[model samples]
Target: MEALEARVEALCEQGNALADLEDHAGALGRFEQALALLPEPQDSHPSTLWVCVAIGDMLFLLERYPEAREFLRRAVALPDGLGNPFIHLRLGQCAFELGDKRRAGDELARAFMGAGDEIFDGEDAKYLQFVRSILLPAQDA
Candidate 1:
């Protein structure tokens, strides 16, 4: 079998490149491949939270909300205080898309709080703002 670290690194590189190009389908594929190579949940492989976050991000981009939720939920369940705010952000997005306004607001708020200044860079931040300022309020009405 290939070295797990090398395989994961290669897959991550490919997925990132594909995501940068807006080729979400290809990115999802690469991320799924990486997820497949990841070791099962064990005390030794604590990096599974990171892997789950990565996969959840791609799945969210692909509009696979249920799958994204599954991955994000797993990442959130990790006991290591290594919480990934991005996963919550993506979960918020998925909840928003599914029209769960209350849950979306809560999740998004957590994401914004958790992400701090890091959430202000790309379109992700823009969308998060849009949801916070426009979508959620609109839904509340």
Candidate 2:
């Protein structure tokens, strides 16, 4: 990682630690600060994906759906995002919460198709399970 990217990664890690401590506001601040260090039209930078995802996830946790959607959109526009199941999953969930059912289904389907067996085997296992339960049923409806 470049110096800035390394610093941003550290900040994001600190933010994650704060979130684990239930200090969401502090986490959000760290995420926002990390995001601010990147250039606009951020898809050019590989690091932008993680920063955007971090900020978007934090905003989603804070119930700022619109803001979350914006940041997550930035994430999905990055080159790495095309193959990222987690990005699609996050966008799908955000779209669901925003009452955009069609978009939610589209994103969720992409996530399901793109993901490997191990995608749901980590820290986000429960969330992926919940998403599968909800979105899979929607597919049949």
**CA-lDDT, candidates in order:** 0.74, 0.78
TM accuracy, model 1: 0.75
**Candidate 2 regions off by >4 Å?**
1-3, 39-41, 116-141
> Tens-digit lDDT track for model 1 on 49-107?
67677778888878889888888887777765234567777777888888887878777
Q: Report the Cα lDDT for residue 29, model 1.
A: 85
User: Against the true structure, what is each candidate's TM-score?
Assistant: 0.75, 0.76
* Residue 118 C-alpha lDDT in model 1: 63
Q: Where does candidate 2 have its weakest 10-residue lDDT segment?
A: 116-125
Model 1, C-alpha of 18: deviation from truth (Å): 1.2
